[model samples]
Target: MISYIESFKKVSESRLNDHLIFWAKTERKGKSKTEIKEQGLNIYNVSDVESLIDTALERGELLVLDITEADRTFSLSDDGKLSLAIFLTDNFCDAYKAYSIEVDAFTEETKQLPLSKMTIMKYFYRGHSINMLKENLALANSSNTISIAYHHHLISNFYGITSLEKDACTFHFAPRLYVPPEWIGRKVTIEIEGLDEPVKLVVTSPYPNKRYYVAGVKLGRLNTANGFYPVIKPRDSFPAHKELLLRWKLDDEIRIDHHLKLNFKFTNSQGRFFSSEQQLLPDVAGMKKFTLTTTIDHSTLSERNARVIVHDIFNHYEIHEDATLVNFPMELHHSVKATSYFSKWYKSWTAEKELI
Candidate 1:
């Protein structure tokens, strides 16, 4: 029996060696320094010619027929040609090595779904890895593919009932997708047989970055038993000490009368919580957007957490909470774009930076 690990190794070696053979088979006959540089910078996504050549040489003597020092050219040996031929044949006959991940999801109450699996059969040439697999897959199918899959996986692991008081559960992943601000407050449904109907969820916030993305999801309780609901949608970051605008919405079922009070609880990194209260008096509640201007005294820090609560809703409290990091000093403007000088240098030398 062929060992999968050994087979993978064989495949990787063959793939790398084929790069060298490609130069030999070209019309120019052998690989020149310029050709080698191009292959290193473009094909392999590396700039160090010495390291690239060293890696090719590690495949063994058979891959290189001759290295002409005078002209700085390379040609594949007979054995290398044979290896390249086998590699080509294998690629045609067998599937290329693919990467996949077994993702698990759950509701804030408990884990409800079995592990969901996704695979990437097509290997991405740059930054070849499992992260690349997911990134490329998302790109190919459109980001919506990942958004749906992420929700499905999260819903599958949910168990039992949950109250609005529960905090939004977060799932961290390397989605490599730019989640727009408009995606916030979007509703998603998950169907399970035992439930009365599909369970609805809303995208409260999504903190996406090159390393990982934090997805904030919570049960979309459009209709509450007490008729008191609040969903706070705050920006990921804002300016420090300045008047920050905190936006939240009241569900249609909520009655914004004199008896109801909306509470905003802000907590800084020091674990201190500040409170703000407002008695809403809307004409009638059919989903209303409210903005409250507030400032955190924590000038030393830039991140905080928030929770919104509806109090005295006929003696019941309905709440929506999220612990996603809300950064301050809006001047920093942290985002997913690769803007560092090193990133630019790397892109100019090789390919684009793999933000996974």
Candidate 2:
């Protein structure tokens, strides 16, 4: 049996969910249905981008697949939902094929697992070979190559406004919008409650990739006393200066590329500042599971204080903070590799379903 459910079906077929295969966005949206009764899937091959995909998710996104050129450009369009295929193979289509015995064996082990609703859906996306799909996603991670193409989502609401105690104050506005590149360098005025004079802050940074702004600066003054973002006061005690690991399941859209500039920050228990902003680049983008990063690895942290409040900083406004996950870097992907294949029975396949 090729699938986990198929093996399970020998004992009981009724327990499995109907394997609904969607090849194109149209089919997923209910505009099309399969007319031909075939056991195989209806998937769009990597070379064929038939649908009008408006939304931009770049894994070397393409109107057509080109194996020769490694270069790509960023553009914005006002189109509807984008439906396109990302190449699982970096250079060769043959690379995505089952090349070794280890992958095949992994597929067998997976099929033997307990049958469940979640597990069944995973097995279906592995195409003919489950192991191949696993390797497909691991392609970029294993190579130590940076994700040259990606983007963050439209960030809405998650932001922090901090008063840097008379020295400087910070505010994040347009909390939900992707600030266009043109807006940077434009000047804006922010009204501070305590200060009689409105703080004149320039849009020094425009971070649209993460939806919210990644960083910002208050022009007037620097606070010598202290600077702090929101902190997650520990419920239990914290260990001494043991380095903490942090990971972010970043919006898959945030592409870490040569052109992309990024920064991250967090504070130690002592209220001392630390940054590993540069260390996160292509590395974060290439992470298999969660993006692996280290916090202030110092001995000064105490029971009530240690590493906390991690952020994926595009700027101050784009700060998304979370507690450190010690076991950082989850194994890439367990399943769900959407591969397109050109079936020999295309004539009959087209007759059965609408493909537009």
Candidate 3:
């Protein structure tokens, strides 16, 4: 029951959707699976829920987690009551566990109502019981701390583009790719519409511990103009609109680190404009969810397409002399969207099969 679905099953059994476990409530009797699942809610563990709340606080994001106690109050030990009161008083200042209890008990009450009129409650021990409850609840509600359900399918997509200078631009790749150790010294080429030739670059692992890769052309090597290089410069004509900002919602299981920088390159396409790099800042690398960021001038452009080269950024002094293309920050890929798509497709296909 430590796993997410198993825990939910333990909590809600076959009668409820996974997300309902979060609300500490359940659908009334006779609600079908279709009716319940359509609510499209997310299930979060106490840690993730707490980390998310902290991240939201850091970004000053507006999140409303409404926990309304029942009309009737239940008895607790004097110490337990005081601890719970103190936790509730400070606006749940990192009290995701308390909220978890509230929801879990509420859901239990719904199921038990048929059997008895008694109110159900979670028992917290006396004294430091609040801390113990938090620890035990976190353990009881644990899920894979870093496992993404559909990571291999790459549901995250190319979300946006940003311009760092006349010659350099950054591509926002989703759900950072795991760079292989073998790819550290590999060479790759990127082709752009306006460029006379493909941009040649090498990949290097700057942070080996993090397993992050960077691919970029070293400007120092450009001193001797070899015929093989593309002319990296601004286009002759600039579009009226030069800026863009794009955002997307992150899936529940996707976590990212905040220190990421957008992998950037130099190009001269008239359609492209100068943009700023939006770092997907998750607290611990691949441990916390991050907000996607992109910026352009006030004007926006249509989605541009390019062949993803070793799709993955760096500074001049910071760039490894042997590195080819610069490595950049990454977003969670299209796994969520792809998962949703396949689920719907599979359900429809199954229905057709049943009819046949």
Candidate 4:
């Protein structure tokens, strides 16, 4: 019994190694053997390999095995090998199940509980892990219905897309198409809607029809003259209102009849803002100065707002107005400068600052 058990363990380990090698071969097609080695799971040793087989059999976890007396080989029964495969598969399935449960629990918890962004991130991470486990398990069980289900589940959960297509045998994320890299021997995916909740697609073969690369480039950036600007001040100050100018520029493509508006609030030192938060001020509003000129048409652009804010130092409070809208004929380069007018009453009231 001891020898049988030992032999079974050895066989189980060998079988696992074989399966792992097969998996590695299919997974690392374009990758080098050295790269696989760097992934922390390369080849197995003779003795340790046997130990895995033994352990599985001892635990009655070996599902399938084959034993043939004619060949004078004492191997595991087919059931034993299958049992082991199922056992390994269970780890991933179990993780996915747990993830689903956690998601349900999170929904329930959040219904009555106030959760922070970090808490939501944790839930997302758990879902991501579940997706990864499902992906790996699908790779291990390729060509099997179980693998297909796993792939489908992962695609639906992470990428918000699912595939039941006839052409593709395997399930895939619909939003993303897998493309083979030109220079590198690995597969790359082009994301359509930026990286947020991006679609993930796997490329199994190197075919011209299976790959695509993104072309054309357009760039834009936001700029301001001074990072700090007072939106409100005392009534006695030099200027009764502050001016804030914003500019925009476009490259490559020309935009027609572009309308621009910014949403912003005046935050105090403690990050608090009062009601009536938005208003259209003259300096940034109106349709007169929003148009783009031909000189800075394609490569550069600029826009300016006059007296955008009023500072009431006597009241010790600032009134935040609505973002002004700028309508232009074409898109161009742009910049902004904000000036503040302070009142004497506002300055005197805030001068004697006291901690609350």
Candidate 5:
């Protein structure tokens, strides 16, 4: 007799019904109809997947059926349940090997068994020694074509911007670890902290989410988010009553030479906050430096550290947390055209005077 395990591979969910039907029909041509019916297997061509599911529910012997999301027949319960396996279809074929896993089944009698689990896998085994026939004829309950790597994931830390049309831009951002199976080929909406409109970004690729996974989204232009970038590292030490140097940049194209308000926050290891605000008229570009006297009395010889977050006065069109477009390509600004606006130098603030 042909081994059930070998027959199982030969008759997967796709051709399971056809193989059973053929077995019944071929035997009927030789034997009488009553003799063929004695095997106690009924074969029928159902109208849809739901009807096929109904056939399974009515008769527990009904084994396999292929289906999509359009419909469902019976919902599973405690007494009877279904194991939903999601897999990328191409991974299974005759030439390639299909993965097999053995799991314990839970039932009234086996409730106290050591390895008992709720999931139910019904099967029969017959063999001896190492060469045993293991038949695992199961239903193709679900299939996901997109292959996602579950083990490989990383929290990404980057944002993106792409130029679109006149006065309009597309901002790309991803929140933390973005799984490709859930993100790719879909449009999602997210609310940024400062931007007015609910931003929408399409996930273009999958990542670690870091191999440029970007977890980053793309937002179209409406009201841009507010931006606050620290230009220079604040002076970490206080020389009794000496100067405290701090600097910042804004992301607004508005050429305001008027003073704007800034609130600076500082926190020590215990998360206690010390805050102060200053008003200064920035240059044509929103950039400014401040040197103030502080009597907060800390050592100049020893080291002290504080966390910092700076907030600017409200600008309705502020581009939050991004300033790259403020220094746009020079060609866009020049009447005719100019060279690309590249960064003059790497940031060397608080470095040696010569480097500055």
Candidate 6:
């Protein structure tokens, strides 16, 4: 029997050598093209040739090729050679070698374990490993199917339960189940059947008096319908403060009502002295457009220095000063774009400086 390590090593070495040869051929052809260009003294560019050479050298170092003639039978198309050269130059060969080594180690470690345990471990390992490979390789979705199948196999083989459904996308493992005692909840173990490996699921019940249900299991593209399952934790509370702004455009005359109310409170570091809620009505009517402004008053820092945050929901912030305390008004205005269906009906505010 071929040892796991030896099998993996053979595959990795073969791939590496094939990549190296492909790169070498591409580099040679590219150099010949450059030579012809140089001899003809034409304006033919060799930048692409130089880039190919660089790629070949990078990939060549990672490949381990045999010096013997029989092992040098690998062949690739011209375009394929160039692409392989680029892949090798980008250190993809090293990444694959690393992955192969990891896989070998994992296989060796799990060799003595029960087949069920080994399958689960390999499923998890391959899932994470393939995810890492995807970050560097733009693999097609179809390529992921193999890994999903492997995971499903592990689950089915380990559990003895035969009723498991494969997802349409072929990237998930789902197992369904139904149990009795609809009023008393209990922990349950789910096993997926039909794999060469072991797969099990452990679920805890949230309600002690109610019977638990297992609705479904979903992993990636794999979804299984088991039944309703108990949830251990409940949801949380809502936020106390949330500010939202809506913009509206006016095509014709309209009446404003008290229903248009802005309810909010503001406080400083000291306490809540400026806590006030009020409804705002349209002060201007029969106009082309106007903006509604809501200002939250903080507190007076000094006689001439009062801090107030003014916002109109859609537009930016504008800090204003009290003219009674200062001789001049110092206003800092910041504007934000309003994303509303009525934005076209509103007029843009004039850019100016005011003291507040």
For model 6 the TM-score comes to 0.16
Runs with alpha carbons beyond 4 Å of true place in candidate 6: 1-22, 30-139, 161-356
lDDT of 5 at 182: 31
Model 4 Cα RMSD, 1 decimal: 27.9
Listed per model in order, the count of residue pairs whose N, CA or C atoms clash below 3 Å is: 7, 20, 38, 66, 13, 25
Q: How are the candidates ranked when ordered by TM-score, highest leading?
A: 2, 5, 3, 4, 1, 6
TM-score of 3: 0.20
lDDT (C-alpha, whole model) for all candidates: 0.28, 0.25, 0.27, 0.30, 0.23, 0.28
lDDT of 4 at 141: 30
Best by TM-score: 2
Per-residue alpha-carbon lDDT of candidate 6 for residues 257-291, written as tens digits (9 for 90 to 100): 11122222221111111111110111111111112
Candidate 5: worst-modelled 10 consecutive residues by lDDT = 145-154
Clashes of 3: 38
Worst 10 residues of 4 by lDDT: 271-280
Is candidate 5 or 6 superior in TM-score?
A: 5
TM-scores of all candidate predictions against the true structure: 0.17, 0.23, 0.20, 0.18, 0.21, 0.16
> Which segments of candidate 1 are over 4 A away from where they belong?
1-35, 38-157, 161-200, 209-356
The number of the candidate with the highest lDDT is 4
RMSD of each: 24.7, 22.1, 22.4, 27.9, 25.1, 33.0
> Where in model 3 is the C-alpha error above 4 Å?
1-197, 220-236, 239-276, 279-356
Q: What's the TM for model 2?
A: 0.23
Please tell me which model should have the higher TM-score, number 1 or number 2.
Answer: 2
lDDT of 4 at 280: 13
* TM-score of structure candidate 4: 0.18
Error of 6 at 215 (Å): 34
